[model samples]
Target: MRPFEFHRPTSLDEALALLARPDARALAGGTTLVDLMKLGVEAPGLVVDIGRLPLAGITLESGSLRIGALARNSAVARDSVVLSQFPALSEALLSGASGQIRNAASMGGNLMQRTRCAYFRSHDWPCNKRVPGSGCPAREGANAHHAVLGTSDHCIAVSPSDVAVALLALDASVAIAGPRGVRHVAIADFYRLPGDTPVIETVVQPGELIVHLDVPATALATRSGYLKLRGRASYEFASASVAAAVKLEGGVVAEVAVAIGGLGTVPWRDRGAERLLIGEALGDAAVDRFCDALLAPARPTPDNRYKLDLARGAVHHMLARSRPC
Candidate 1:
């Protein structure tokens, strides 16, 4: 890794001041940023340590779930309140990295995690996301894990956050603090598609630091689960994963939310599928239609075309498992 000045700030104001400098990056848990630096994918001149700041609380005020950015992934997954209120979120966290990693990775660091695309990581490859205008070799290269939805000609790398998929299904929002001020951005709008400018990944500004995550409680949260299909049972990223939350009233669907990861450029949420399942019985026809709603617009590459079928079965199975019959 390149040599860089490290500054540990105790207060938010002091951290923001350090981040104001050019090529200055915030270091929360050092889970993702540190790896990228070692790979030479990212190199910042100044690293502002935000781990000492008091932002590691997990609160459930009224009905909403409030998670501090510094909260560890394992703590959130093992929290009794989170397990009872948002099982899908807990499941997604556990489905990801090993227990050791979960103990060290922070919620904010997970949000800022980069894609696991092979081309993007290898400095030898011509990846548009790694180096703008270099051209994306993944568009025609070995793309067995590339995205099928929300992809642009410039890039097709999939988003690699398992917990973020569950968060999106819960309609979560993030509280961001920057030089301008503090503002809450909905999770749906946080990620940007790999458009012509694949370099710009998210809505987060240069100096903005994610302070907290806001997940509003709903009946859907009580009846939810996450399913991940990977090459192995553990310590592997999902080839196609589904986070499903469904609420049924009198054997009929009342509310539903579903999001898929490892199948899109971002944590993919299909409101159309949610709308189609509302007020309808969970029958084969309804389930088929729901799958169609989610996978109709998918345009997969030749190598990863099986992801379409895997996603369909994952959606069907996740909803079936979430049923409180």
Candidate 2:
């Protein structure tokens, strides 16, 4: 890793001040940031250590589950409130990484982590996400793991975050702390689609820090589950996954929220699927329509077209898990 100045700030104000510097980055868990530095993919002049800035807590407050950004992934997964109230989210956290990495990875850092696409990590290949206008080689070469939805000619890298899939299903909001003050952005609006400039992955400004994740309580939140399908049984990234929450009334689906990962540029959410499920039972006909609407926008390449079938199976499987026995 390149030698860089590091400042451990005790206060949020001080941390923000340090982050205001040119080419400065925040060090939360050091899981993702440190790896990028060693790969020469990222070289920040200064790293503002916000690990001690008083932002690590998980609470179920006022009909919502509020989680501090610095909360450890393992801690959140094991928290009583999280396990009871947002089990899908807990499952998502536990399913990602190994036990050791989860112990060190922070919640905010999970979202801030870059794509796992090999081209973006290696300096030899040209990637628009890493270097704007360099050309996206993954589009035509070695794209077995590339994205299908919200993908453009510039980039097709997926945001590898299982927690993000769960959060999107729960309709969570992210609280960002900036120079102007704090602003709450819906999880749907937080991640940016790779339209032309793939370099900008999020709506967060350079100096902005993600402070908290606020998830509202709903009937669906209590009855939700996460299913991840990977190459191996353990410690592997999902090839296809589903985070689903549903509310059933009189044996009919009242509401359903679903988001898929590992197949889209961002955590994929399809309101059309939810609309098709409402007021109807998840029978063969309804499920067929749900799958059709869910994968309607998917533009899979030749190598990764299998994800369409995998994603469909995941969605159907997770939705079944949510049904009360």
Candidate 3:
């Protein structure tokens, strides 16, 4: 790791001032940041610790759930209301990392975690995301875990956040504070696809602090679950995952929200699939159609062709299991 100075700011203003500097980065849970630093993927001159700020509480409003950015992953996952109402979010959080990591990983840090692309991590490889215009190694290199959608000629790395996927399905919005003052960004718009600049994973302005995420109140969101298919049962990343939130009224689907993970540069949302089941019964054919629509436009590489079928199976499984909800 490179030598760097650290400052644990007690107030939001102090942290914001430090972050305004060119080479300073916020340090949240440090679960993702520390790993990237060790791999030499990120080397900021100053680590402005924002974990000390008073941004670690969860509030249940009249309708929505307001989650502080610094709220621990375990805290949110274990909340009775979250577990009962937002099972998908709980499942996603429980499916990631480990118990210790879940305890240490904050809500904001998990959303801001870096990609898991090998070429991006290996300094020996030529990656444009690592070094601008250096060229991409994953294009013709080992890419079993790379993205299948929203990829660009410059990069094909996928966002590695299960929680973000769940939040996308829930139609959440993030509150951000920057030099320009506080603003809100829809969670879907918060993450950016790898177009020309793969290095910039999010739409967040520079020096912006993620204050909190607002999970909207919806019957669909309350009846959701996340399903992940990995190589192992624990401590593993998703090979393909599906997040589904469905609300049924009078034995028919009333509303649905679908987002996919482990297969895209950003949390993949399928509006067509969501529409297929919105006003119909979620039968096997409806489920299959939903699955097909979700994977129809998928563009997978030779190394990860199985991800398409894996994603299909995951979608089917999640829908089938969610029926009793």
Candidate 4:
């Protein structure tokens, strides 16, 4: 990693003030940020260590699960309330990285983690996300793992967070703190699509820090499940993954949410497709139609066209598994 000044703040206020600097970056678990720094993709002159901040807590309050930004992934995955109330989130967290990583990775760090695009990670290639207007090689080059949904002419890199997908489906919100004070952003609005600005991936301001995430304790969230399909059995990024929740009322679907990852620049969700399944049973025919509508906007390259089928299968499996026993 490039030589940089590191400051371990003893308080959130100190951390925030340090992070307000233009070239400062917050360090939580050092799982993702450290790797990018070592790759030379990220070079921050000031590293503010927020690990000592009072942000690591997990609690159920007012019918929502509040997860502190610094809470470890393994702790959240194994929390009894999370396991019972938001099993999809637990499953999603467990499916990511390895046990050691889960122990070290923080909730906010995972959400803020960059895409795993090879071109962006490597200093040898020109990537739009790394350096805007330099051009995106993945658009016409080796892009078998690139995104099918939310792709623009500038970038096709897929989102790599499994828990973000699950949280999107669960209707979560993130609390961000800055000079303007704390603000809540819905999961749907947290991640930005790679339209004309592939370099800007999220709504978090430069000086802001994610404080916590709140997942509403709704019937749909409680009935959710996640399914991930990858090239390997372990320690692999997903090729296609689905997180789905369905609330059945008298044998008919009452409420539903479906979000997909590894197939989009951000966690993908189609409310129109969800509407099609709102009043119907999750039968194969209805599920097929839902999947069809959900994948209708996909623009997969020839190399990654298989992701469409893989995403469809993942949706089917997740929805089926999410249904009441």
Q: Best candidate per lDDT, number?
A: 4
Q: Please write out the lDDT profile of model 2 over residues 91-170, one tens digit for every residue.
A: 99999999999999999999989999999999999999889999999999998888988999899998899999999999
Candidate 1 has an lDDT of: 0.90
Model 3 backbone overlap count: 0
lDDT of each: 0.90, 0.91, 0.87, 0.93
Error of 4 at 285 (Å): 1.6
Which whole-number lDDT from 0 to 100 does residue 265 have in model 3?
Answer: 89
| Model 1 agreement with the true structure over 1-325: per-residue lDDT tens digits | 8899999998998888888887998888788889889999989999999999999999999879999999999999999989998999999999999999999999998998999899998899988988999999988999999899999989999999999999999999999999889999999999999889888888888778899999988877878889999999979888999988887888888888999999999999989777999889888789899889888878898999999999889988887874666
Clashing pairs in 2: none
Which residues of candidate 2, in runs, are more than 4 Å off?
Answer: 322-325
TM-score of 3: 0.96
Error of 2 at 297 (Å): 0.9
lDDT head-to-head 3 vs 4, winner: 4
Off by over 4 Å in 3: 322-325
Candidate 4 has what TM-score?
A: 0.98
Question: Which segments of model 1 are wrong by more than 4 Å?
Answer: 322-325
lDDT of 3 by residue, 1-325 (tens): 8899999998887888888877888888899888889999899999998987999988879799999999999999999988888888999999999999999999999988888888888898988888989998898888898888888899988889999999999999999988888899999999988778888888766678999989987778778999999999999888898888777778778888888999998999988778889877878899888878887767789998889889888887777765755
* Cα lDDT for residue 130, candidate 4: 91
